[model samples]
Target: MEKLKESISSVLPVTGIVFLLCFTISPVPNDLLMGFVLGAVMLILGMGLFTLGTDLAMTPIGNHVGSAVTKSRSVWMIVLVSLLVGVFITMSEPDLQVLAEQVPGIPNMTLILAVAVGVGFFLVVAMLRMLLRIKLSHLLIAVYLFVFLLARFVPREFLSVAFDSGGVTTGPMTVPFIMALGVGVAAIRSDSNAENDSFGLVALCSAGPIIAVLVLGIVYGDVAGTYVPVAMPQIADSKELWLLFLTAFPKYLKEVALALCPILVFFLLFQVTKLHLPKGELIKICVGLVYTYVGLVLFLTGVNVGFMPVGSFIGQLIGGMSHNWIIIPIGMVIGYFLVAAEPAVHVLNRQVYTITAGSIPQKALSTSLSIGVSISVGLAMLRVLTGLPILYLLVPGYLLAGVLTFFSPPLFTAIAFDSGGVASGPMTATFLLPLAMGTCSGVGGNVVVDAFGVVAMVAMTPLITIQLLGIYHKYRFRPEEVQEEEAASEDEDGGDIITF
Candidate 1:
C-alpha cells in the first residue's frame, strides 16, 4: 500500500497538470461533461495499472535475463542476444509507435522497423563496451561527432525527427528492463570495476535510434516529405469516450505482448539451460508480469484516448489565444513538473544517488532535469511560433552538448546522454507532442518543420544541463581539496595559524 502511494504521488503531478491544461485550456464542450468524466476515469486506471506492471513484471524479467546472459562465457552469443533483445523490445515501444504514426514522410512500419534495428545494433555495441571496459565518454565523443558530420548531409526535415528518435525510442517499457539487463550483465563479470559498466546501457541504447534515423535520411535522400497532421478528436458523449478507450486497449495489449515475448523466450531458454529461480520467486515474478500487462493496458488506453487529444487541444487553444506569449511560461512550468512524474526518472535518480553514496542527491538530479526540460519546452514553443529549421537549434545544441562531454566527468556524460532519452518518456509523447501539433495546426505552421522537434528539444536540453551540473560539482569539489592542501603546506612550514 505504501509503495503504491509512492508510485501514485510520483505520477499524479504530471497527470494533474495534463488534466488542468486540458480543462483550463482545451475545455470540452459543456454538453460533453460525461465524456470528460469517462476519459478521466480511464486515464487514471490505466496509468496506475501500467506503473504496477512495470514494477512487477517487466523489470524483473529483464534483470533475470540480463544476469543469466552474463554467466555465459561466450561473448559473441551475449552480444548477439542482447542486440536482438534491444531491437525487439524497442519495436514494441508504445511511445515509439506514437512517434512513428506522427512522422509524415516515412512509412510507419518502415520507420518502426528501422529504429528497432538501430536500437538492437547499438545495444550490442553498448553491451560489448561494458564487457571490454571501454571508456563511455570517448566512445560518445567519437559517435556523436560522426553523427554531426552525417547531419550535414541528411535532409533538414528528417534531422529533428532523427534526433527525436533517439529520445523517444527509450520509453517506459524499455528503460527499467533494459537498465536491469545492464546491471544483470555487469554483475556477472569477475572484474573489480563491474559497477561502472552497468551505468552505460541506456546511453548506448540511445545512440541506436539516432544513427538509424540519420542513415534513414541518407537513404531517403531528398524525397518529397509529407507531414502527417494530427486530427483532434472531439468527445461528443460518454459512450464515445468509452468506445475510444476500448479501441485503444487491445492495440496496446497486443503491443506489450509483442514487446514481452522475446524476453520471455530468452528467460525460458535460460531456465532450460543454466539459471533457475526458486519456485516461489518465479511465481512472484509471474504475478508481477500479470500486473505489468494490466498496468500497461490501462496506461496506454488513458494516454491515447484521453490525454493525447487534450494535449493537442490545449496547445491549439493557447497558441490561438490573444495572449499566445503565455504558452512559453506555461510550457516551462509543465515541463518542470512533468519530468518528476516519469517512473524511469525516479529509478534513474534513485540509482544515481545510491551509487554516488549520497554525494549526488535525488533532489539535485530532479531539479537539474526539470530546469533542463523547462528550457527545452520554452524553446519548442518558440520554434512553433517562428518556423525555424530544427537544425538551426539542434546543430548548435548538439555542438554545445558534445563539447561538454570532454569537460564533464565520464559518468556525468553518460547520465546526461541517458537522461535525454529518460526525459522524453510517455508524458512527452502523450502530452507535449499533442501540444506542439495543436499549436502548429492553429498557427498554420508546417507540423513537420515546426512542431516535430519538441521531443528532440526536450531530449537535448538535459544533456547540456545535467553535464553542466556535473561540471559544477567537479569544480565545486576541487576548491575544498585545494584549501585542505594549502593548510597542510602551512603546517609543514611551521607557520602560525591565521585567524580572521
Candidate 2:
C-alpha cells in the first residue's frame, strides 16, 4: 500500500499539470472540467502502475537477457542476437509510434519500421562499444559531425525533426529496459573496468534515429507536413466518459503489448538458457508486466485525450493573444514543469547519483535539466513566433555541446548526451509537441519547419546545461582540495611555533 502511494505521488504532479493546462487552455465548453478530473485520475493510476511494472518486469528481464548474451561464449552469436534484440525493441517503442503518426506524407508504419531498424543497428553498435571499452565522447563527436554534415544535404525542413527523432527514440519504454541491459552486460564483463563501460549505451543508442531520419529526408525529399490542432471533445455525461475510456483502452493495450514483446522474447530466450530466475521471481515479474500494461494504457489515454488537446489549445491561445510576448515566459514555465514531470528524468537522476556515488546529486541534475529545458522551450516558442530556420539553432547548439564534450569529464559528457535524449520523454511528445503545433498553426507558419523542432530543442539544451554543471563541479571541487592543502600547511606551521 505504501509502495502504491509512493507511485501515486510520483505520477500526480504530471497529471495535475495536464489537468491545469487543460482547464486553462482547452477550447471545448466542458472539456476543461471533464478532462481535469478524468485526466488526473487516469494519469496518476497509469503512472503508478507503469513505474511499478517496469521495476518488476522490464528491468529484470532486460538485465537477465543482457547477462545471458554476455555469458554466451560465441562472439558471432552475441552480435547477431544483440542486433535482432535492438531492432525488435526499437520497433516496439510507444513514443516512436506517436512520432510516426504525427509525421505526414510518409506511411506511419514504414517510417516507424525504419526508425526501429536504425535504432536496432545502433543498439548493436552501442553494445559492441561497451564490449570494446571505446571512448563515448570520441564516437559522439564523429557521429554528430556526420549528422551535421548530413543536415547540410537534407532538406532544411527535415533537419530539426531528424535531430528530434534522435531524442524521442529514447523514451520511457526504451530507457529503463536499455539501461538495465547496459547494467546487465557490464556486470558480466570480466574486466576490472566494467563499471566505466556501463555508462555509454544510452549515449550511443541516441545516435541511431538521427542518422536514420536524415537518410529518410534524403529519400523522401523535402516534403513537409501540415499541422492540425486536435479538437477537444466535450464529455457531457458519464456514458460519454465511460465510452471514451473504453475506446482508448484497447489502443493502449495494443501499444503496451507492442512495446513489451521484443523484451519478452529475449527474456524467454534467457530463461531457456543461462539466465534463470526462481519461479517466484518470474511470477513477480508477470505481475509487474500487468502493472506496466495498465499504467501505460492510462498514461497514454490521459495524455492523448486530455493533455495533447489542452497543450495545442494553450499554444494557440497564447500565440494568438494580444500580449503574444507572454508565450516566452509561459513556455519556460511549461518546460520547467514538464521536465520535472517526466518519469525517465527521475530515473536518470537517481541512477546517475547512485553510479557517481553522489558526485552528481539528484537535485543538481534536476535543476540543470529544468533550466536547460526552460531555455529550449523559450527558443521553441520564438521559432513559432518568428520564421527562423531550425538549422540556425541546431548547428550552433550541437557545436557548443561538442566543444564542451572535449573539456568536461568523460562520464559527465556521456551522461549529458544521454540526458538530452532522456529529457524529452512522453511529456514532450504529448504536451510540448502539441503546444508547438498549436502555436505554429496560430502563427500561420510551417509546422514541419517551425513546430516539429520543439522536441529537438528540448533535447539539445540539456546537453549544454548538464555539461556546464559538470564544469562547475570540477572547478568547485578543485578549490576545496586547494583550501584543504593550505589548511594542512598552516597547521604544520603552527605546530612548529607552539607558544604562539
Candidate 3:
C-alpha cells in the first residue's frame, strides 16, 4: 500500500497534464486518450508491485551473488562471473529490446549482442575499479573522451541512438540488481570510501553500450534509418480499448519472462552452489519473482500499447499547430514530473537515502532530478525545433560534468552519473522518445536527427544538477563541522553497510 501510494503520487501529475492537454491545448483522439488513461492505471499498479518485488527478490539475489563472488577472493572468478552476469543482464534488458526494435537498418539481435558485449566488458572494468580503488572521475573522463573521439567517426544518425543506448541499458530491469551487486562487493571493505565505490557500477555500465553501438555505427557506416510513425489505434468502442490492452499483454508477458529468466536462472544456480539458505526465505523470493513478472508484464503493456500511441499523437497534434513553440514549456512540465514516475528512480532514491543515512535527503535528490530533467526536456524540444546537432550539447555537458567531479564530493559525483541512467528509464523511452519522434514528424524535420536524442538529453543534465547539489552540500557547512560529520559518519558506517 505504501508502494502503491508512491506510484500514484509519482504518476498522477503527469497523467493530469496529459488529460489537460488533451482537452485544452493539444486535443488527442478519443481512442488514444482512452488508451493513455488505461495505461496510466496499469503504470501505477505495475510500478507499485514492481518496486515491492524488487525489494523482496532482485536486491537479495544480487546481494547474495555479489557477496559470494567477492568472498571467493579470486580475480579470475570475479572477472568471469561479472562478465557473464553483465552479458546476460544486458541482453535481457527490456529497454534495450525496445530501443533495438525502434532503430532501423540494424538487426535487433546484432545490436543486442553488441550492447551485451559492451556492458560485459565494462562491468568487468567496474569490478576491477572497485577492487583497485581507481578514481571514478578519472576513468569517466578517459572513457567519455574515447566515446566522443569515436563519435566523430560514426554516422550522424547513429550518434543519438548510440548515446541513448547508454541511458536505457541501465534502466529498471538493470539498476536494482546491478546496484545491489555493487553494494555486496563494496561491503567487504571497511574503508571510508567504500560507499562511494559502490555507486559507479551503473555509471560505468551505462557507458559500455554507447561505445559498442558507436563501433557498430562505424562498421555499418551510414545506416541512418528512417523513422516509422506508430499506427494510431482506431478504437470505436470500450470493448476495442479492452482488446487493445489485452492483446498487448501476451507480447509483454513473453518479453518480461525472457528478461527475467536469465536473472532467475542465475539466482537459482547461485542458491544451489553458494547461497544455501532456509526454505522460508526462498519462498519469499519466489513470491517476489512472481510479483516482478506480473508487474513488468502489465507495465510494459500499459506503456507500449497505451502510452506510446497517445504520446506520439499528442506530439503530432501540438507540433502541427502554428504556435508549435508551446512544446518547449509543455515538454519541460512533463519532464519535471516524469522522472518520479520511473520505477527505477524510487529504487535509486531509497538506496541513496539508506546508504547516506539521510545526510542527503530524498526530497532534495528528487527535486534536483526534476529540475535537471525539466531543463533537458526543454533543450531537447529546442533541438527539435532547430535541428541542432547533439554533439553541441553532449560535448559541453559532459565536459562540465567531468570538471565538476573534481570539485564535488566523490559520492555525489558517483550518484549523479548513476542518476543519469535511472532518470531516463522506461517512461522516457516509452513516452518522451515517441513524443519527440511524433513532433519531428509533424514538423517535417529529420526525425532521426532531431527526435532521437531525447533520452541522451535526459541522461546528461542530472550530472550537472546533482554535482551542483554536492558542491552546495560541501559549502553548506563549515570546514570543521564537515570534518566532524565525516568523522562521525565513518565511525558509524561500520554498522551502516546496507544489507539486502
lDDT at 441 for candidate 3?
85
lDDT of 1 by residue, 443-494 (tens): 8888876888898899889989998988887677765663464356345532
| Candidates' C-alpha lDDT | 0.76, 0.77, 0.89
lDDT of 2 by residue, 337-365 (tens): 67876667756776677766777778888
Tens-digit per-residue lDDT, 1-500, candidate 3? 99899999999999999999988988877888888989999999999999999999988888888888998899999999999989998898888888888887788999899999999999999999998878788899999999999999999989998999999899788899999999989888778678768898999999999999999999988864667788889999999999989988888888888888988898889889988978999999999999888888878888898888988998898889889999999999999999999888998998999888887899999999999999999999999888999999999999999999877777888899999989998899999998998888889998877898899999999999999998888777565666566557546542222111
Compute the lDDT for candidate 2. 0.77
TM-score quality measure for candidate 1: 0.89
Error of 2 at 412 (Å): 1.2
Stretches of candidate 3 off by over 4 Å are: 481-500
The clash numbers for all candidates, in the given order, read 9, 0, 0
Worst 10 residues of 2 by lDDT: 491-500
**TM-score per candidate, chains pooled:** 0.89, 0.91, 0.96
Displacement of the residue 254 alpha carbon in candidate 2, Å: 1.0
List the candidates ranked by lDDT, beginning with the highest. Answer: 3, 2, 1
Clashes of 3: 0
